[model samples]
Target: MPVYEFRCQACQRKSSFFVRSIGGSLSPACTACGSREMSRVISGFAYHKSMATIHEESGGPDRPGSDYYKDPRNIGRWTEKKFKDLGMEMPSQIQEMIQSAREGEMPESVKDLQPNLTDV
Candidate 1:
């Protein structure tokens, strides 16, 4: 089961519910205001660990005491593998985007939105 977050428009309260399927519709009622007008928000998952944490927890990979850094190709490989696992075709644009990121060149689409990291 997956958890989904929802915000009540009437009372402005947020709640989370475990949903069996992503396609299922949720009740719009607000727990506080009893209003049937609520909006769904992106929910966070608590049960899973991130890739970096998983790597660290596994004793830094096969070589003991060696720092375990993710392979630069891992992202592209994972992206391709995920599509294969889902029985879906990988889009060429996504492949290109991963390639560009690996090459350290920001994609033209998001170039203008780059943040100024020097600014605190």
Candidate 2:
């Protein structure tokens, strides 16, 4: 099986179509808006990472260090891992909050953690 990606001209959203063989034909429609006008785009490739590679880039979640939290991807990883360990899906709201924090939004509750600037 092969997957081909196309960008819908109408909505500018991407959609993928799967072909059973390399010679198969496809007339994929926009998944979002059902538009027939589509443009083929280069899709990102994926590869499998070995255990060693994963652990090396994992930033030592179990092992602690001052710099461990420097990477934004590392933030909320503990909560994510916890949810995964419990075999439960994280609520969309919490996921959104974590994503927002990763994108540098300060949560309202953490605003008080900031030092009083006038006192400096």
Cα-based TM-score, every candidate: 0.36, 0.41
Q: Which parts of model 2 have CA positions greater than 4 angstroms off? A: 1-58, 108-120
Best by TM-score: 2
Which RMSD values do the candidates have, in order?
16.2, 15.4
Give the clashing residue pairs of candidate 1, or none. Answer: none
Instruction: For residues 61-117, write the lDDT of model 1, one tens digit per residue.
Output: 233222222343333554566578889997888778767756765566533232232
Give the candidate number with the greatest lDDT. 2
Q: Return the TM-score for candidate 1, rounded to 2 decimals.
A: 0.36
Error of 2 at 112 (Å): 12
Candidate 2, residues 1-120, lDDT tens digits: the string is 456789999999998787677776788899999999999887753112245555665546455345555566666666677688899998887777778777988586433333333543
Assess candidate 2 and give its TM-score to the true structure: 0.41
